[model samples]
Target: MRKILNTAHIYMIIGVVSGLYSRELTKAEDFTGDTQLDVVHTHVLALGMLFFLIVLVLEKQFTLTSSALFGWFFWIYNIGLAVTVGMMTLHGTLTVLGHSSGEAIAMVAGLGHILLTAGLILLFVTLGKRLQPAPAPGSDAAPDPDPAAPLPAPAP
Candidate 1:
């Protein structure tokens, strides 16, 4: 879970940096200049920061890392996000510098999206399995944080 939280913080920082970069990109003309970097911040924030936050919440609800696929899901999702963001940054920078990156960039970006989708599916499947009937309110079952749960458990 610590890894998840740390990753989320990193994502937030990157998102903020991206936003600053985008703003600076347009500052040359009083915010009138268009920038390909316009969506970088949102993408990083939503996919990186927000996504992990939701996972953290889910982690509290379920023992995600106890499942075998959790590791796969985590690594795959990060790789996909990194690939997608890297492609975006590369393409955007090239465009801003007046260079045509050609069709490869689009193809690579599409591949990244495909990986991202696969990772999300893995995550949802893992989450869905844990969504079984909840304990009745005020039952003997301890409400989450499951005092007994291991500290190293990862997020959903």
Candidate 2:
């Protein structure tokens, strides 16, 4: 799960950075309000993704007593992200297909980034639930070790 999350984090970072740089280059060639807004939105979404990735990494490493609570929160956050991205993708598709009348091709490309973000969110949530911490070794409510018993005692 950690590996998957790390990979997603790297992918998102690269994608957003590439997008921002590309938009800036485009603006330099011909400044436009739409390009400026695209740059802002990319940076904002990248920041949010970074925060979520950090939380996921921390949860992967730390075993809190209320780990399940954190897990649920993360799960809900992911679901929300999925919904947001899914809507954006739907809107973009409609616009691209000419079923809708007012949005641009660049906006549709931004929706692609949202789709990737949603997929990564769902992947992390599912893996995080499955990879929950196991009980610490030797911490089960078993009978105390018998000093009289030799090492490698028989299982109960």
Query: Would you list the C-alpha lDDT of every candidate in the order shown?
Result: 0.84, 0.51
CA lDDT of 83 in candidate 2?
46
- lDDT over C-alpha atoms for residue 65 of model 1: 75
- Over the stretch 9-112, how does candidate 2's per-residue lDDT look in tens digits? 75476447656654655455553423233443354355446655665565455432134554544544455444444444444334333455245544654555
Kindly give the stretch of ten consecutive residues in candidate 1 with the minimal lDDT sum.
27-36
Give one digit per residue, the lDDT tens place, for model 1 in 21-140: 877765653455455588888999999999999998788878787778888889888999988988898887776766778899889888889889989998988887776667898889
RMSD of 1: 7.6
Off by over 4 Å in 1: 28-33, 133-156
Best by TM-score: 1
Residue 40 in model 2: lDDT: 38
Clashing pairs in 2: none
Root-mean-square deviation of each candidate, in angstroms? Answer: 7.6, 10.8
